[model samples]
Target: MSTLENDSLRSALASTPRPPRASAASAALTFGWRGMLKVRHVPEQLLDVTITPVMFLLMFTYLFGGAIEGSTGEYLDYVLPGILVMSVLFTTVYSGVALNTDLTKGVIDRFRSLPIAKPAPLLGALLGDTVRYLVAGIVIIVFGVILGYRPDAGVPGALAALAVTIVFAFGLSWVFTTLGLLLRSPSAVMNAGFMAIFPLTFLSNVFVDPSTLPAALEAFVEVNPISILATVSRGLMEGNAEAGDLAIVLATAVALTAIFAPLTVRLYRR
Candidate 1:
């Protein structure tokens, strides 16, 4: 080959891609565990996961239960799942905020300079935040049980419901993570991102029945993904598994993950 052609061939050969290894998983786990340890240093953030669930359970079950659902027992049964879903939804917003903070503080840049896997920070954040979701779910369920909010589906079913909710939250963290990376401002990302989801939770079946809502609001509640998730959760807890409800919730979660995971990875790469 000519010198120019030989030089080009060598460059192409050197640029050939190699398969990624299992070490990425180890890096993800290590970074995720590091995030968990960071949370230990700032334990106050956990208060929302542990305490707010109990407080919301009590507030809704006793204060507004009679006025809305006619009895505290019935209302507790209805709102418990909604509270669980809402707690996870609200908690997921912090993922974006935290991501933005890391970017602002150059923490992500420092990680980028390391030899770790590209997805480590994002994956680790998702895994670490899952602890928050579990704490929130357990506290809410335990308080609900104490307050007579028995799940008709028993322990296994309750656990399944919690698992679905956590998976949904984990998928949602990708969306927030992407937003955080794109925005690069913690307060702006959090406020605007959460503002978008606020109506999704409030306008849904969280505190009221869709059938009782005004026609305009009822249409929104019917279409809201949060409402669909809440319905699926309630169905599981109440042992009334409907094919349509489960399908919708699963579809929404899968769709969100498909859209956000690639976007999040792209953001991380950038």
Candidate 2:
């Protein structure tokens, strides 16, 4: 084409108006779907939500159930809720690992060039990771049922218990998301997250009764966030939901999100 025609085409393109950046909610969901697609491409990413939970459920129930609660059946009743909490907590580490991978690999650089909300990637990762927790919840419930475990609170209660756990896990992901941005490697993110969460899950009332612990340990368990979560889940699923325990769990989630969400945003912007 002649220079005149090329100049005319360039002028027309420059005059065209582009749409505004998408709303944070819409961009978040879109990127969230993208995150889910990543899971499809890497099926082994699901081992934490699937294989790990099943193994924990089986090992904990059969091996130590009788010793801890005097019979496998009775222990299964008491253990399912706590195991569900533990499963989701353990799986949350993957959020940090995935986020760190994206950052280290320069995926975030491509995102920066796009006209989307800055927070979309982080929110999307957290939203997508909810599916992982949901899968773990289902695995635990199905295995518990097959093993003769029954929730006294029935379906609605069990669902409420799952919802509570998912919400808490969602908030907790921000803590790791911040680590993913600040840390140099995905492995470092995983190690740091595990170091923070392992003691919270194990030292709390997840595997055993708080009363059975020593005085100092029991003191920590009583106020431990995991203990609050386990108590809320057990109470809700067992038809004894206490207003106080549920309140504590909800408060803990809110506090974690409030503390870490801004930190993650700040670090990611840097």
lDDT of 1 at 156: 79
C-alpha RMSD by candidate, in order: 7.3, 1.7
Over the stretch 89-161, how does candidate 2's per-residue lDDT look in tens digits?
Answer: 8888888899899999999889877788888888988889998899999999888898998899899899999
Candidate 2 achieves a global lDDT of: 0.91
On lDDT, the candidate that comes out on top is 2
* lDDT for each candidate structure: 0.86, 0.91
Residue 88 in candidate 2, Cα distance off native in Å: 0.5
Clashes of each: 0, 0
> Model 2 segments beyond 4 Å from truth?
1-17
- Pairs of colliding residues, candidate 1: none
Q: What local lDDT score does residue 167 receive in model 1, on the 0 to 100 scale? A: 83
lDDT of 1 by residue, 139-233 (tens): 88888888787898999779888998998888888889888998948999989887988878899998889999899999999998888888888
Poorly placed runs, candidate 1 (over 4 Å):
1-22
Q: In model 1, how large is the Cα lDDT of residue 169?
A: 87
Score candidate 1 by lDDT. Answer: 0.86
